[model samples]
Target: MILAVDVGGTNIRTALIASHGGTVQELRSRVSLGDRGVSENDLIEKLSALFSEIISSHNDISAIGIGFPGFFSAGSGILLSSPNLPQLHNVDLAGRLSEAVSLPVSMQNDALCAAIGEHRFGAGKGHANLLHITLGTGIGGGLILNGVPYTGESGMAMEFGHLRVAGSDLPRSCGCGGSGCVEAYASATAVSAQYFERSGIQTDAGDIYERACKGDKHAKEIIESAGHCLGMAIAQAIKLLDIHTVTISGGFAGAWPLLHPAIIKSLDTELIPPLKGKTTVLRSTLDDTAGLLGAAALIN
Candidate 1:
């Protein structure tokens, strides 16, 4: 069995997977790193304790795999930087975690892991070329080309969220210090922020989606706008890569009932004549478990 770990800003989720790709056990714990600043040592200690708790009970585990939310030296497993966990910058996370647990460890970007999971076992299965987009607090993307994961030279190939979709006339600011990025409009954070700006009520993306479901015009419009921007970005990508199959997964993807129409409309309007109506966007079947299965696949 391989132990798969998915580390996020708010939680660390772990699971045991069989060699043939089935989940054996799963566990989750709060990161508890509050508003106060976090340190590398604190994060490592927290992860170590969690791994220890699981390892003590599962004697069949052979190796460990991690899906981390950051940029890293793909060959070395040394994290370069993480917008969410900056304290761990330049740390050899895989090496440290391996030492803490005395097991071989492999790591990859969380979104890339999700793509691998989907390509191997989920919606993207059987596709030689696929694009996977995750719409969460921020947007992330992964690509599969000719039956393999492609991370580019710097291990940051598919930074789809940062793609500039808006012109200079109407710039939208993004947390990455850029303007006009698709993520500025299409992320869950963007959805909630847009709703609060127009409604003066602070709520999450899910609640806004529920309001849209109830025929709230303002909420509906906000989500449609997000979907339109997302479609625009996808059109640009498809034009460049000529990949027709796209899979979307994340918390906000549950609102597909509302987002799909706008996305398809935008795609129809934006795509070139020959490429029009050729794209297929699929929802992930593995849901949250994609990342776990992907992490396990790394070591398997």
Candidate 2:
């Protein structure tokens, strides 16, 4: 068995999987990193405690795989930058964990790991070219070309959310110090922020979705706008890569009903005649475990 860990801003999810493919067990632990004083050592200790618990329960585990968000040296497993987990910047996560656990550890960008898992076992299975877009706190993505995950030189090519696709009317600033990026409009954070900006009500994306489901026009419009921005970005990606298979995942994607129409409409409007209607966009089939399973794929 292999242990797979997906580190997120809000929670850390871990799982045990058969080396071949498939989850055998899973667990979720809320992360407490919002405190300003939290340090890298604190994060490391929390993760170490979780790993120890997993190792104790599963003695047959042979390797460890981690799906970490943000900028990282994939070859060295050294996190270079983490906007969400700022305390972990420059931390050698895989090296430290391997030393503490006495096991081989491999790591990759969380979005890339999700792409691998989706391509191998979920929505993108059997496709030669795939794009996995994650719509969470921020929009992120991974590219699979010719059935292989493609990370550019030094492993930082697929920062799709930072792609500038927003117009002046919706030019919200991003954490990356950019304005008018896709993430500024399409992320869950953006969804809520947009709603609050217009309606003067502050709530999470899920609540906005729930309100939209109950026939709230304002809430529905905000979600559609987000979809339109996301569609614009995806259309650009399709035009550039010529990849037809795209999978959308993340907690916010649960509102697919509201987002799908705008995405498809924008795609139809933007794609060229030969490419129009050729792309196949799908919601992820792996639920929320794609990251975990994808991480496991790295070591397997």
Candidate 3:
């Protein structure tokens, strides 16, 4: 069995996966160390305790895998920076976790891990080259090129959310401290904010999606705008990588009924002539399990 950890901006989820059959046994979910003013030592101790708790119950665990949200040295597992968790910097998270748990630990970008999970077991199965986009509190992207995960030379290749999709005149502030980024326009957070801005109502993205389904014009417009911006970003990525298959996952993806049409419309309008109808967008079958499965797959 491999212990898989998925560290997100809002939550930390862990699971045990059978190496052969890919069966997953989720342990529990915990609140993540996000903007809580926790120190690096505190973060390590918390993670160690969490792993130890799981290890005590499951003795078959042979290794540990982590899907972390941050910029890291892919080869060394040394985290250089994390936009969400600003406290972690230049830390050897994988090595320290391995020492604490006495098991080999492999770590990579959380979105990239999700891409790997999709490629191996979900909607991306059978696709050698594809793009995986995660639309949650923030937008994230990953790439599979020629049957291999591509993280680029600096391990920061597919920062799709940060892509400049909107013009400077229509600036939308992003969490990454940038304006006019695709993330600022298309993320779940952005969806909620945009709805609130339009209707003077404050609600979560899911509620907004539900409202859209129930024939709320404001909600529909907000979701449609978000989907269009997302499609524009995907178009730019496709132009660069020439990858036609794109898979989307995460909480906001539940609004596919509304997002699909807008995304396809934007793609048709923006994509170059030769690539007009070649793109295929798929919804994830693994849902939230993709990250955990991908993390465990790192062990093999």
Candidate 4:
């Protein structure tokens, strides 16, 4: 048995999964992150409580898995550049959590973990070439080539969201400091910002989709633009990597119906002949449970 955890800036989800690869069972858990009104100790406490409960109920668990939302140095099990999680940078999250629970633990970048999960157990189950693009607060991704997760030399390649758009009004001011990157236009945050800028209505990603369904023109426009931006990136990715499958996950993907056409149109214009209609883009089969389940894969 393995305990897979998806720890994010706002929420943390944990689940128990079979060690060998089968159906993953989600465990009930949640923790508010950051230091605004919460302390790191409180965060630790929540984890400790959950761990204790799990162990008490199922002492057969042998290890723990963590899908961390940040740059991870697997050699050290420490978090790096965890922008969303201000309290986690340079912290030995895996070590601390392992000590608290008395279990062996491993961690990976959440996006990379998702890619592995998709390739090994989800949509790209039988594919050797796979890419998992997460379209939530930011457009992040993980790549798999020849059935292996490929993180560049320094463990941070395929930062797909950072790819720049040739000519655009928007410039990326992401933590990485790039310009007109795909994330600035395709991300859920970006869509909401566009909507807010146009209609002066601040809304979450879900609300953006909801409003669009109700015929809010501004909301509809923002999401469509985001889709186009994503499609352009997808087209480029296909041209360069020739991956067989691309899975869109995260919040914005939920708004896919509003964004799919634009993405298809954008990809149609730039695609190469051999890859024109070869790549398969689809939604994630795993739900909120994907990250947690993916995290669990590290232990295997």
lDDT of 3 by residue, 14-46 (tens): 988887526778887565654557778888899
Which 10 residues in a row give candidate 2 its minimum summed lDDT?
28-37
- Of 1 and 4, the candidate ahead on lDDT is 1
- The most accurate candidate by lDDT is 3
How do the candidates rank by TM-score, highest first?
A: 3, 1, 2, 4
Q: Which 10-residue window of candidate 4 scores lowest in summed lDDT?
A: 31-40
- Residue by residue across 123-156, what tens digits does model 4's lDDT show? 8789888989988887789998998777676566
Stretches of candidate 1 exceeding 4 Å from the true structure: 33-37
Error of 3 at 145 (Å): 0.9
State each model's CA lDDT, in order. Answer: 0.86, 0.85, 0.88, 0.78
Backbone-clash count (model 1)? 0
* Residue-wise C-alpha lDDT for candidate 2, range 1-300, written one tens digit per residue: 999988877677788888888754885554443454567777667777778888888899899998987666756788776767666677788888888888898888999999998998899999999999988998889999998788887678688998888456747888889799989888999999988988899999999999999998889998998888888899899889999899999989988998999899988987889999999889999968888889999984
Candidate 1 RMSD computed on C-alpha atoms after optimal superposition onto the true structure: 1.8
List candidate 4 stretches off by more than 4 Å: 36-50, 74-80, 85-96, 170-172
lDDT of 1: 0.86
What is the Å distance of residue 16 in model 3 from its true position? 0.9
Candidate 3 at residue 49, lDDT? Answer: 88
Model 2, residue 107: C-alpha shift (Å) = 0.8
The local lDDT score (0 to 100) that residue 196 gets in candidate 2 is: 93
Q: What are the per-model C-alpha RMSD values against the true structure?
A: 1.8, 2.0, 1.4, 2.8
List clashing residue pairs in candidate 1.
none
lDDT of 4: 0.78
